[model samples]
Target: MPICPSCGAAVAGAVATCANCGHPTGPAVVPPPAIGEVVVDETAAPGPSPWGSGRIHQDRQWPTPSRGWLTAGRVLLAPTALLVVLATLGSTIAGRGGSGVDDDPAVRWTVHTFQMWLQLTLTAFGTPWRNSNSSSFGSSTSGIHVLPYAVAFGWLALLWLGQRLTARARAAAGAAEPTGPAAGAQALRTGALSAVAVLLLGWLSTGSSHVDEDSLSLSMQVTTGPAMLPLGLSGFLAAAAVVLAVDGQGALRAEAARRRWLGGWLLAWQHAARVVGALLVLLTLVSVVMQVLVDQPFPQSTFRALTVNGGVYLFGVGSGARAGVGGLRGGHEGTFALYDLGAHGGQWWLTVVPVLLAALALGWSAHRGRLTQLDRARLAVLYAVLTAALVLGTSIWLSESSTIKGQVHEARIELLGWSVTSVVVAAAAWAVFGALVVPAALDAVRRTPVPVSVPLPAQAADEPDGIVGTVELVAEERPLVGQVDVLDSHAAYRRPDAS
Candidate 1:
């Protein structure tokens, strides 16, 4: 008999089987190796995974400098083409056919006018412009800062669409949401590219017109100066809008709550966008109604008038006019007279437009949740500040000079002039009332408790007959506990056992 090495059982036969445990009890057989050999278990090695890859990379892959430039170039082409087409159509429609000039002169005039419209459109999109006129007698220079919201609206639409498409493309390619630094870098790149492109376009759009006559000669020129801040800000905002749209509002609110200063600005921008967007919608509706009521032959002129008027009404600033006369020796200065055409004018109802819009925007924000009363108050103040700054940036100034029999006459007009502090004060008051006070008041009304009367239990029959059961007044109160509401009611009652 042989004992089993593993279980300490005795083998019963030569077949090497243990009697008690049925274990192998024979000496192990070993194979001999030739030279040097290494062994590996093929079964233990990993096979092909069913999920294809091990881990999906989540980091955003930013474009290289060269690649970024190429992408920016591609993005530039569409807007550039659109701008050119719009400028051409606007120039063709609004331009006075060069009736007094030859074919060559007419062509030159058309081209220059087209360039002027292009510059104006650029100016509407935050570029700054300088206008100068010189003649045989005198010269005048002025800067125009009026924003044509129609053009701006179109450009912003295009920018928003482009960003949306880009974000979708990245998502389709299995890319994750971009980190803060990555998003910031992308915005900076977009802003820098936009600024450079705007500068180049401004340089190309500079135009001058000359009128040479028998006795009098006049020359007028339009050019753009450095507008790095405005152009870059426009681009940065466009990029940020895309990020907000893609990431959703919850993320924005969370980010704002995390970083007080930077987050507060982002939150304020969100409110500003909502406020301005609503105002634009209201203005558009008014313009449509005006168009329907009034028969205007030139749609372009109608559009220009509506945009300018809407801007003036929303900013609550008046227009002013000034005229001066100059000779070879000296010039007589004229007093600047302001015309009340804004909210303070005959159309005082215009003040209600922004108020109503701000109220609606604040309501929407509250419905979305996550904002406290303090956050909303801060948002209102920031919105007012932003709107006032925007009004300041878009204020318009126009100056013109002409030489008549060597005695020059000059006229200047300023729209949205000399009342910035007043506008700021008004905006702040309206924003607070509409965005904070009104909403809070409404919420309080909605949460108020309603009282109900309930009869008290009958007194004992043995008690005095004159002692009657009094009615108990109860009120339903709901206190919020986390996501659930607990009902609590109170009423006074006398017990039967009490004297």
Candidate 2:
């Protein structure tokens, strides 16, 4: 019997997968060559280059749990402290006494610090809710209004830094054999841990609130607990994404084994995941621009505004708005309204256009691959529908609303289901159309014939020509042909040139 290379467990000589750790045993079980035969490295250099470069670099190992945590702490601490200082400085500059910072300094240093860590970690999604009250009925909001593009830049930097930290930790710890656990299982574990950490941090931080006396007098609570469920959910997703990317470096020798376990559906899901991840990041960027162009009256609550707006942009969900005005009688007439497709087409285009282009590109790429026409179409449809649903569901789940208490006239807020339906329908149509057409168009263009220029030899000034032989050829031209066909062409032969 042969032993499992990954876990040192016994395996039958013919078994392909390890019984203990699931690593593929095939790659490790190749028979040795016969004694007389030898192999040579034809591409290898004769010796080291003059600059002294002959060493091959090793792959970075995955960090263990303890190392990963230690790295997370070091990587997160500086940013958290810096953000805290910046938040305080910003408040001081704005003359608001750092209300955006935690109410208690201790909380700011510990609980809020972790909150900040979670916030930056989840920056790829959007900024965390500031939980502050709105300014007077129509005053400028005060909290940090993080732009989506900026957050994206920060998130990318964080990703690079995080990966680098893990690499350094792994290098220090020395390379070791991977445990060969399932990728999905590893991702789930890290994602769950991150979510729990965020939830606990939010819960502990919520105890200290930055009470807004002015907003409270108006019968509104400005500061409250962080949106724990949403935060945890976002954290879990963010962590999972990072974990998957990191785990990509692991189990290089076991990918075939992993693939055997993961069938066609899993393979398709992986592709879908890539598209959705890209869409999310792209939409986040679009949402940032949308926020800038469409100014909101509530500047004091800009943090929540960006958060809600980002959610709406990503999901296509509707939102509610309340307005108060003076009535003919003594009382104020207030109205509440919801727009399923709350964002304007102009704003929606900011999202729709990029996604559409991405879809078309994806279709073309798929067409170039081993997938069949049906596979390409199915994938395109899958991507389009899923993208739309993601936006719709996110909108419904993460929608935001604020209350108004000022006196004014008739106010009305109504839900427009048809608009939401229209949005969804439009998305599906765009996706299906793009999926079917873009690749076909690309293929057609690729097949089109282009005229090639030929150079004729220069005539000699004084050369004697003698009749050598004569030849005739037939030629014909056609506008276009789909399939390959031989065409007749006319050719003429002349005497040979003598010099």
Candidate 3:
């Protein structure tokens, strides 16, 4: 017996086509390649031709480590160059301004722009920063702006290009394209390369640091201030992790598209992370555009705006998160902190957007993954818990702190940090809420009326009938019982209508 591929119905072994679905039998199955197998193309010409296409097709081999290294270097160089240019321009402007008054508008604006860009890059890479020279205490100097998303945009572009080059190289080698463990290895290699590039840039930007005991002050050579190497390295690695996770998602989506279904657990989870992160990035971009449309001046106003937006997205904090500058009258630069709901003037409600979006992304991905509602709930809860834990840990360890010159004494301040408790609470609340909402939403989308076939009964063939019997109504089965009450010897009945 043969089984129909489409309908799974049994058929005779000698059948040319399936009887149930009428599909042709014996369709070909693509065989998987064996380990260490080298696939050869027999159609290529033996000798080199006018075009180099033949040679490339004939000489395909596995991607060498040297090629990988070169690819990584090329991918990382563009953004590094841009950072160098920004540094140079800022330095020139600062030197020219120092030759004049402290209020030199051109120099101030240029320096502010450069510092903002640098800060955005650091934030995107996961390093928190501080403003050491602010005169106001606890006044947020900057508003929500565009720089962080800009950094993210550049980072993702480089990563995508790197992956594309690696894929091209793999194809040229004529070996099997890497997947599973091999893909992981490739992603790690790329991430390592990117980390090195970012670490070097951080070192260059923050070349020197000095502590002044006499004046009770600390100053760094960079405008945005110097970051510790280890911290910068960790931040770079975090960014790299985001990139690799995104790459994994691209692969998963591609596979899913081919198979017409969601991928396995690991891929699905990666996809979920990718969705949430991408949404955050998108939100940042939108904030940037909104600032511009509202006529927020460039550099001065935009710098603070960028910081506000970056702080919120990176830490799961609200837009009310800001740094308060205590001017000279206060004897300190400023006191900056993630304010409580009561202190933030009701802006705490703004935190709901990202948390809600994150939960929705998680739920949708879980549904697409073919998980049960229970599984979706579990996944949502797990993701939220982990995010909260991670944010809390980052807030504790990665919060930026510095000592600045004060009128009376040395002032040490901690700023640009998140509230661990708030983050945890919001994450849990959003996850629970989204878990309840998402299933119903997906159900509505999937609901459709199934069309039914109304079956018709079979009709008999027409035929002529010969006379065989008289037409009459038969007596009921219990006729004797009804007539017994009036019967005497022979039974008789009178019709009421005849009388």
Candidate 4:
């Protein structure tokens, strides 16, 4: 018997049109039984979503990367508060016999550059509160710098402002949903690249001592979460929540225009700044070399200050699941011991290089619409390795730490040298945090609804053929209980296109 082309109903093999819908059907596969998730109507013309349903779409057109009014505003939102403090500090250093802080344009510019970094660092705390104490974090900074938490909060506020503006723009554009990356994608890449520059600075500034040393570490006794998560991560989570809230409802139609700018610019900016911070660190090496040439100049220690920091990241991240169980036992102490980067830190850069490359590749993957389930799973593993390498490298650097006795020694050159090195490295780290954050934000920018088209997937053809059919096994008479396939058990026929 022939099935009606339109409705896939049995037609005694001689029907012209479907008696059900009074429509003609073409060379498409016969409809299947009313089972599983999909229900096919032979007579209806398919639209993107179910009749009135709205879903986010991925394709987007970009705006001008630079020179936009909104862009300028967004730029100012960050680095404003930190710049003010850095400028004051830089001036005080110069005014108080700090030659490097003297009335020099380069020095001033460097200070400006450094301020950008300082802001990011403070921002990490997510809020500002004063009362400097090295005892614990998310607490007072002894009024030395703005409270870390405050800085973080400020960053959040500014970021939200930018988002609000962008959301408005999306609304004006008639977008039915919120979707798109933030503006900092480029900065994220810049931060990643800056890692290399920091290494070079260490080599240039300090007359290289390839030895290990003991340093203070709180990590040995505790396991903790990231002190501060980039606001962008929060943003990504928010977007995912919203996406879930309205799955197929047309209510989220406004998200379309908002997602256009989402994706990896912040990474680039951060890496770029990190490069500059690294240069400042190299000045320590310059101070040492200069001291040798003329009088003894400023002297600074090596990379031994990050042990605790690195240990914290590793202990929390490596075996996070077992941390609690191990914590009760003494074996889970998170203290970072002496670490060696084989060949006098020659391999240090190797760790950094691969991470940079991975970030770029991931960006490309996002560009290619490959952040699907499988791709995302693969990328997650790649990121874990990259993060581990970073933690390892930083930990190793702690083996050469230069201690602070709280006195001006080594002709003040040493003090200046150390100050520069500390700030520079800190700034580089600042860049990194921002860089990573930007991508999280951008990737989250996919608020626009995606449209799923029907007609079956392209791979429906090429199966071995026997027969193709549909069965509407309704439970009107015999109700379906528990779970059952309901349709043909063997699915004997191949795809109609294949046959």
Instruction: Answer with 2 or 4, whichever has the higher TM-score.
Output: 2
* lDDT of candidate 4 over 1-499, digit per residue (tens): 4445444465444445666677764444243333244543444444443321112234344554332233334433343444345435544454444543456645554433333333324324322112222222222121111122223334444544544554455334333331122223322322222223222322222221122223643322211111223323433333233223322122222232122211112222223334323432333343334445634211122211221232222222222111111121123223221132222323223223323433444443332332333323333443443343333322111001121444221210111111223323433343333334333445568442211211112222432321111111112122333332223211111122221
TM-score of each candidate? 0.57, 0.44, 0.49, 0.22
Model 2 over residues 1-499: C-alpha lDDT tens digits?
5656556666766888987788998766544334565444345455532221222334444644443344444444433344344434433433332335536544444444444433433333443444445455732212221333334335445644665565444434332322334334545665676667656655654533444466556543345445567777976777666655564443432342244322223333445556666766665655666566667521113343234335334344221222122222222234222333223333433334665556666655444532335544566667666756554432211123444465332322221111345556656665666556665676677762211211111222222331111111111233333321213110001111211
Ranking of all candidate structures by their TM-score, best first: 1, 3, 2, 4
Q: What is the lDDT of residue 5 in candidate 3?
A: 50
Which candidate, 1 or 3, would have the higher lDDT against the true structure?
Answer: 1
- Please report the candidate that would top TM-score against the real structure: 1
**lDDT of the candidates, in the order given:** 0.50, 0.44, 0.46, 0.31
Q: Worst lDDT window (10 residues) for model 3?
A: 454-463
The parts of candidate 4 lying over 4 Å away from their true place are 1-67, 83-164, 172-376, 389-499
- Candidate 1, residues 1-499, lDDT tens digits: the string is 4445555444555656666766665673122223355433343335532231222333444644453344445555555566667767766665544333344534544667677667777765655556665665556656655667667667667766676676565445434444445555455555566666665666667766665664544443433342446755665565445444543433344454455654545554566677667666765666556556656411223335235345434434321221122212222223122243332236434445555665567655542332455556666877677556655554455555556566676666653343455557766776776567765665666662211211122432333322121221221233343422122110001121222
Q: Which pairs in model 1 have colliding backbones?
A: none
Candidate 2 residues lying further than 4 Å off, grouped into runs, are 1-65, 71-161, 164-204, 207-223, 227-237, 248-301, 304-355, 393-424, 448-499
How many steric clashes between backbone atoms does each model show? 0, 23, 23, 82
